[model samples]
Target: MKGVIRTILLIALICIFSIQFTMSMVIFTDLDNHWGKEHVNWAANTMELIDGFNDGTFRPDDIMTRIDFILALNTLLVKKNIYQDVGLHFGKGINISYTDVDRYHWAYGELAILATYISEYGNADIEIKEIFTEDTFNPNKPINRHEVLLLSRAVTTPPIEDHIISFKDVDANIPNYNLIIESVNNGILRGYSDGTLRLDKNITRAEAATVLRRVATDVNYLADKFLVYEDIKSRNIGIELPIFQQIDEHESQSQLHQRFIDAITSIQYSAFVGHIPYHERHLYDMQPIETLWGLKNQNYYNVIGNNYYLIKYDKDLVMERKKELVKEGLQHLKLNVNSSFDGLISFLSIAAELLPMEETMNAAEATFRQSDNSKTKLETGLFIMSQYMANNEMDKGLNIHRSLLEYEFADDIKAQIIRNYGYLLYSLKGADEAIRILKDLKDEMDLDFNELNPNAIEFTFNGLMKQILIQSKN
Candidate 1:
């Protein structure tokens, strides 16, 4: 009975200790005022990815050196077994080639492994030219804010929507401004509350711990790339297809959206035979809508809907029609930026991708600048920005939209400007920004999810707003 009692007590004690450890296994004394305190604790105590120099003091604000980051990265991969995913085995095949880092160096094994990987496999997760200009491994060198961008992008598969953030200090023409914008968008780098990126600054120890924790724990970082139907293709299988198709006479708005998703994502079973689905192509965060369609048969129909239709969509027909559209769209460029409506859209889509954006943007900028009427200027800006949204050239589009919004406008024009901006945000999967921008409009306006496509069958504007809010929370 005494033994049994002792065993019960022991089990209870173990469970309590585990609960405490799980709650916060390592507490840092210096992180009381730091924004990344929790991340520091999680990375240190939970994942064992980082550690304090001494008992209970994490020294969270100290600048991290290159070696510290490399070791933290090594721990994240090796200790947590994420290295298996990347096919990295640290000790073997390591060559101590860096002039500064000898085999006896504290971080030699990890540093050597990284060196070997980079030297042999020129195509690393990030471009080699982005980092490592020389043979000297400056392991103790303080990593700059911009350098973290190179590391974070290599480590985390976060979304890459540029011009998503701006700093008061960063000018658009500066060499690093665009990179900083993208880094902020990726959540790898953040700005001060006062709106400065302090681009020249080195990241503190606290910041490094948080960034490392993000790579270790953030869902967006660890998520697998997937194929949603809309990513593979679109509504038209080339040629002219009617907006409404093979009737689901009583389909709900949700069901209609699902149908749209299914149509673009579907394929004939025979067409799937030699294709490798779920390919692990996670070398870098893919740009939006990028997918691996490495298939033996490249031709697949963009089946319009679930139900049968009168038209035949052969592989050859589909390919030829798409080519013709591109060709026609290119030919429409004869009207140049002067084209209106569909012709204008086609020109923008093709030209934005084909022509040098400098030339295209220069011509576009002149048109808006030359317009004397506020309405025409707004319309031109909105039109060009809309094309940018459509073509996934959101960074350039965002710049155009911002310039338009800064101008003083009549209330109605201002409302339209705000709405157009919100619609562009919505297209970029920026649910929060979309809602925020739309709410800025003081009057009743369409909040529908049909900004890009007038005939898009989705939830009502309010419904979609609510849906995305719920999703964002999740």
Candidate 2:
């Protein structure tokens, strides 16, 4: 009878263990499904710099310091080689800039400098010791959901092609306000339905975990990894193992803080992809030109010498149709224009073809003068002349080109300009002067005409000079 009792007791213990294991597995699975899906998507799509997500949980609502945001931005920038260094600098001693934040205070000195984001207000110098007021940076305080959205938007670049997030409540005029709205609009963040941004509220540990997880999954930096934990089996082990691992890695408070730092840096680096709009030709071809017509309605005029021209479209409807044709031509030109010069020339040519000749010339002249440097300004002037010449306005084009020749620029650039000017003279009724200029250019300058575009520099000594000679004989 005693042996029989022992067997029954052993069986009962096994059953209890199995029941606990099953219950834990269920909880783990639920948490994993609930948090992991969104977290993975966010990390993969929004933040791609973070790796090893399966090994950690990100606690989002935890108070974030000024150092945290900076470090994160630095990390993202570093990955893209946008900045040369990563980390912070602090003034020595217990000399925190403000009474509330002392040098020895954790993150005080760092936060003090990072507070420049708020201090950008019309020369208002930020004081560190100042308790973080509403619409200000508070290093010691917890970061709220609204603030998180703001941070996300500030660090990322513009032209975020993502779905917009809608928040029931968020004023557009607060500090870092538009960023918060943009973040939500881009689906990088979300808020409660109560229509409150809750900017001053502290974030909870679990909430932070959820946020971090979302960041990880969206970036695709840490989706595949081994997760291990004791008692994990009891919590629906396999399904929730990843989150447990993350939390376990941050078992100590300091570790948790460091992990947060690392995670933020990763998010910034991999979130945004910047590229020129014209690089993708096939994609641009499919997009309707009407979408870009609104750009033409923004008027710009230029007054050069004795002529005034309007670059702005007078009629919105006609401007829209013209824009569509120009866009189509641009798409076609992109196929043949392999060099940057060719691309630029093609773009200008297309613009000239679509807009009025006077408008194109005025726009080009205005663009040239506004350039901060001489080289770009000279190039713009040359492009304007080139367009004018194409439009049979030789006198106007020659006058602009003459102005360009007077500018002090590099030897090669000057040579090109002289060659074009000489060609322009030949095109008019000044064959003798054109021949003299071309002969002087060939004799004085050591240049490889072959290295330049044959079509672009068609007025060069070898090309245009020969044509002029043949025409003069005829």
Candidate 3:
């Protein structure tokens, strides 16, 4: 009787396996698209569920809003039975807050507690009223491209090694930049042909789905199953079908589905993988001075300056080569500086018209230091002040402008300085002071309308005027 009972139990187990295998095959027929096609062959053996909108539109371009991410996450959790069979409902409410999020917002209460991805400064409670800043969570704004990469890294199990996705653009100083880079190294994501990760751009849904599928396969939560999608051609299915088949048969349905969702949501919470090969290439072979002469790639120059310091003495013999390259680069820069001085002066003269206030200030400072003649210094100083009104460092710029006013210079240069100073005061949210200064300059000089190079004067004046007008209206 004991042997018969054991035999009966073994038969029941076989029947259950047969049933599960059949269910997996049926599910394979439903998956379609690049992501589905890749995993379809193995999906029958794997019990993973690939989740996204049913319409076959991955929406790779749309931003993942907070609500959308929460819904996707909850769907994964529900499938996984993470909350248990007792059916503890993931409550939804509009009025949840812990002094950060707005009570009336859609994801105000539920997502914070349920996802638990973010926590208050010192506790587990959600900070509801907290406005999302660059370093903090901002629910409403479109997530940047780099954030998606970081999120993917976080959910990934047994985190990847350091320095995999090396990018020229990502500063090492950025928080958790290294972790995100490692995820790319581990084959979790990829970067574009361009050397930049474009961290500021928003991520789309299709991109997220593709990432999810890759992570799911890596984690052993998916089965290797062969599948064919109606929309995806046989040639395009490639290796993905077999991978899907493997995961489908071996894993539970809930596990497969959760992995898919996790992949999709990873985009908004991670750093972007940059062009690794190119970055390494530039690092090893310092570009020739001629290469940077009239060079368009300022980013490349910045990388060289920041990484291979020409100023420092090092035990590495490569340091000598770097210093020689820097000397050559400086020679080329000097030529450009001299040849472009007049153009630069013209540009600086009407900086308010052509450049941002910050840039204008930069040009002004550069000119003042580089100019050999006192006349040029006075002119550059006036231009600097004119453009400096919009700067956060306006007080510092003003002080320098006042000092220039004491110097004896050519009448033409001095007049330009006075006119520019008046314009600067006007632009710096000091309309009353600006009017008084402008009146004095207008009274003192024979204003040459043509000498006011339109290219130099128009752009800055118009831009400042527009800013002033907008501010006044607000």
Q: Which one wins on lDDT?
A: 1
Candidate 2 per-residue C-alpha lDDT over 219-328 given as tens digits, one digit per residue, 9 for 90 to 100: 22111111110110111112211111122222444443333333323322222333224554333322222212222232111011001011121233466655654544
Model 3: how far is 58 from its true place, Å?
A: 4.9
What's the C-alpha lDDT at position 129 in model 1? 37
The local distance difference test score of each candidate is 0.51, 0.42, 0.42
In model 2, the Cα lDDT at residue 349 comes to 50
What's the residue-level lDDT of 291 in candidate 2? 19
Best by TM-score: 1
Clash count, candidate 1: 1
A best-first ranking of the candidates according to their lDDT comes to 1, 2, 3
TM for every model, in the order presented, reads 0.42, 0.29, 0.31
- Candidate 2 ranges with C-alpha deviation above 4 Å: 1-31, 36-74, 77-100, 104-109, 117-131, 134-140, 150-188, 191-196, 200-474
**lDDT score, candidate 3:** 0.42
List clashing residue pairs in candidate 1.
60-206
lDDT score of residue 113 within candidate 1 = 60
Model 1, C-alpha of 91: deviation from truth (Å): 3.8
* Two-way lDDT contest, 1 vs 3, winner: 1
